[model samples]
Target: MADLWDGALIDAAIWHARTGDVARQFRYRALYAALPVDALEAAHLPLRPDRPGLWRLRRQDYGARDGSSLTDFIRSQLAPVGLSHCQITLVTMPCGLLHGFNPVSFWLARDDAGLRAVLAEVSNTFGESHLYLCRHPDKRVIAPGDRLSGEKLFHVSPFLPREGYYVFRFDPGPGRFGAWVDWFGKDGDLRLQTSMIGKARALTASALRRAALRHAFQPLRVTGLIHWQAVKLLLRGVRYRKKPPQLEIRRSEATAERSDV
Candidate 1:
């Protein structure tokens, strides 16, 4: 695994493309933080946990979202599936200037054997979230080329129905990180494609300040962009799908069913 503890910045770009009824595509540069589950307790960094700082990573923003130990929450989910004793790194957006919102965050679990699993914590504007666990059925290392898939149980966009599956791919490296999530319909037709690809560098105090200067009020900007896109889609005459009832079980798991080079 890469030495992620040295820094916490992922200078990344996020993109989304829709190929369904309406054709829409967009990309934006975004900054993210990479924090190992163990490093959440470290207080030496400019970014601190559960407190106000220029950059903040609140434990209540993830996992159970109840101000619980995120590490323990990750372990509880993995232990039941025989995936304990693994290292976890959370790649997410931290609260910038005491205001934050993450549409999605990733919990990357790895063991001495190799990449074991990934928990994609996805949230929507409805103030709800869901967890999708992706791994291999035979407990094999999840290579970059692997395509792990799971059904779409939670409603994300009002323009799309709650029927489909997501194909997830990850490229984890020491100096860079990349991930792709493509949505497909019941007929196996591609609907949407989204990705976050970026370079990793040491996040010193200076670096944090630079990022702040570049992307100030990032959380609000992100939220506004989301609604702005929705309005665009609405103006484009895309039908709006109502949000469904909350899922009793807000978590789902998928096995790596195939690999494509």
Candidate 2:
């Protein structure tokens, strides 16, 4: 962790563990960008916005995916929930020259008071996405200890069913970033647990360049690891669930839940 930076490179370790009939777990190091949507690019960094570079943030990668203004898209999502005026920050994997894929990305909306809401943008291998808006019932600042629950609407992993709710916890601290997700079945049993935790480094040419070297072809590597884990699960005789129909609506609000963590 380091001093807070409007834009930074997060060096993280992500992990997932299943606690059901078939037990499995995996962890890996990764890199992510904590980007300010309005100030996508800085002259001091090697990254660019909506252009080809060793590392870049393309507007088309998130929100509407139509190369639209990310700020406007985020504003629209927050308006109905009374958070339109909050500042927007996107935490996601930076795209390479050609390919990119993110299992999940976070859109944080904050006011002067503190973090007000978060939009969890989730995607699957089958090419579909969903947005889960998380906020307190009273639209108050979301404390680090608070947990939010939302109905699982999109089919993410074939190993998990669509009939569960996801309990989410986030820590968007100035010096570090962390998020946790637990899948609870309709019967009220926890099926899977996943998390991403990391320290932050200000976005700079030297910092990003070093990170890039450590994670060359990061997007491709991520996709490969996902499939590799899938192969391991299959070998373990885990039953594969079929992909269901696409979710018609893409966004829904999540409710704050009582938590002991």
Candidate 3:
């Protein structure tokens, strides 16, 4: 087993144990916290339907993150790793939008042969549908690339907005999460592929902890190499019976805005 895989599995276990997430929440939280407040504040909170053609809302607009209870807590977790920027997005659902990490999932890996074997094991052991391995939203793969290369929910969810999918990348080196696993690299403009998680924490913890202590929260910074943060956003949030502000985007326009046209 690769050291990176060991660290990834540990990282996965940590994710599951701490955040109840199978995906990369530590980095996600760091990324989100690192984002400039202005970028979030400036982006048309709630992203009301541009011209009032297709989308409608039951309430006024506000960025989901703005209303999030975790916003303040997330803001203050004292992240050891710092984030450069993370594009925050919101989608309007029948009731409310969903977040990927709300659903619990553990990490797995795909080295040279790919994670098909590991996923197959998951399906066999859990009685999970094999089709999910192909379509589940939480799956992610990291390798050298121009853009993330693998099965992405945005690719399948035709109803999602175009900007819904964004990838964060930088110069690759010893990263805050862990060093590169030789998992992949870019070739002639095409992104390559590989997958793994969990146990990564154990394998690379010493060096990563040392580096993190040395750099103090800076990403490894690579252009082609990637730190993929896969998540499985649950569909349950779409139900909006009780309302204390879920992720739903308010699309209802304000013709009643003080002065009408």
Write model 3 residue lDDT over 87-124, tens digit each, in one string: 11111121122111111111222334232111111111
Candidate 1 lDDT over 133-224, as tens digits, reads 99998878899988998888988889988887889998767787888999988888889999999988877779887887776678878888
- Best candidate (score: lDDT): 2
Among these predictions, the greatest TM-score belongs to 2
State each model's CA lDDT, in order.
0.83, 0.85, 0.21
Candidate 2 structure lDDT: 0.85
Per-model clash counts, in order, read 0, 0, 35
How well does candidate 3 match the true structure in TM-score terms?
Answer: 0.20
Off by over 4 Å in 2: 1-5, 41-46, 258-261
Per-residue error at 200 for model 3, in Å? 9.8
RMSD of 2: 2.0
Tens digit per residue, CA lDDT, model 2, 181-226: 8988888889899999999888877888787676668988899999
Q: What lDDT score is found at residue 175 in candidate 3?
A: 21
Higher-ranked by lDDT: 1 or 3:
1
Which lDDT value does model 3 have at 145? 32
